[model samples]
Target: DTSAFIMELPAYHLPYAMTVLKYALDRAFSFVKRAGTIIFAMNVLIWFTSNYNWTLAHVDASQSILADVGKVVAVIFAPLGFGEWRATV
Candidate 1:
C-alpha cells in the first residue's frame, strides 16, 4: 500500500508591528474581561456555599454546605494523596 500527501504553504512575510500589538492587546483585554467575569461569579458562588446551610441560614464555614460536600469528597480522594476537606474544597 502507498499513500501520497501534498502540502501548500503561503509566502512568508513580516507582520506589521503596530497591527500585531493592537491585535494582541485586544485579545488580552477580551480574555481578561471574560476571566474576570467568571472569577467574580465563582467567588460569589463560593462565598454563598461556604457561608450558608441547606436551610439558607448563615452558618460557620466548617458547618456549611461546601464543607459537607468537601468532607465527602475528601474521603474518596484520601488514598490518592492529601484529602483534607479544606484541600478538597
Candidate 2:
C-alpha cells in the first residue's frame, strides 16, 4: 500500500528537513520584514478607504467604532494571544 511506501522514509530525515526549513523560513522572514512594510501600508490605506466609503453611506463615523472593528478582526485572525491566553492572565 501507499502507506507502507511512506513508512519506509527515514525517521532521521526529520532533523535535516527541519534544519533546512528553518533556514528557508529565516530568509523568508527577513525578506518579509524588508519588503512587507509596503504591503502593510497598502492594507491600512485600503482599510481607511473602505471606512470612508462607509461614512459616505451614512454609517456611524466614530473612532470607537473603527477601533472595535480593528479589535474584532485582530481577535478573529490572531486569536492565540488575544483570546484564551490573555483571558487566563
Candidate 3:
C-alpha cells in the first residue's frame, strides 16, 4: 500500500520526492562514511594493540592492548548506563 501510494503520486511530486530522497541519501551516505572511518580506526587500533605487548613484543592475549583501551571506553560509556565493554567491543 505504501509503495502503491508512492507510485501513484502526481508528476509534480516526483521531483520533490526525488530531491528529498537525494538529500536523505546524501545524509545517509555521510553517516556511512563517518561510521566506516570509526570502524577502520577501531580495527587498526585493536589489531595493533592485541598483536603487540608493551615494549612491542608478543605476549598473552588477556593482557593485550585492546583490553586497556576497551576498559577506558567502557568507563566512558558507563555514565550512559551501559558500563559493560564486553558486548561493546
Candidate 4:
C-alpha cells in the first residue's frame, strides 16, 4: 500500500521549485545592483576629495579619511569584482 501510494503521487512538481528559485535569483540581482551603486558613489566621492587641494595640514587629514574609506569599501565590495574599481580611482 505504501509503494502504491508513493507511485500515485504526481510526477511533475518542478514548477513550484523553479518559481521559488526564480524569486531568489531576482532578489540576488537586485541586491547586487544596489551594492554596485553604493560602491560607485563612494568611489566618486573619494576621487573628488582626493583631487581637491587644501592646506598641508588639512590635506593630510583628508587623505587619511579617504584612505580609510577606500579600505572599508574595498573589503565590503570585494566579492563584486570591484578590486580594479577601487584601485583605478
Winner by TM-score: 1
lDDT of 2 by residue, 1-89 (tens): 66756655555634588889999999999999978998999888646644554344424333333544555566665645654222321
Best by lDDT: 1
The collision pairs in model 1 are none
Sort all candidates by TM-score, best to worst: 1, 3, 4, 2
Query: Which has the better lDDT: candidate 1, or candidate 3?
Result: 1
lDDT of 3 by residue, 7-71 (tens): 45455634578889999999999999999999999989878887777778776655666666667
Clashes of 1: 0
Q: Which residue pairs in candidate 3 have backbone atoms (N, alpha carbon, C) closer than 3 angstroms, thus clashing? A: none
Instruction: Please report, in order, the local distance difference test score of every candidate based on alpha carbons.
Output: 0.93, 0.59, 0.76, 0.65
Quote each prediction's TM-score: 0.78, 0.31, 0.53, 0.41
| lDDT digits (tens) for residues 5-89 of candidate 4 | 5645557645688899999999999999999999999988766566544432345523545555666677767787765334523
Off by over 4 Å in 4: 1-15, 54-89
Candidate 2, position 70, lDDT: 57
Candidate with better TM-score, 3 vs 4 = 3
Clashing residue pairs in candidate 2 are none
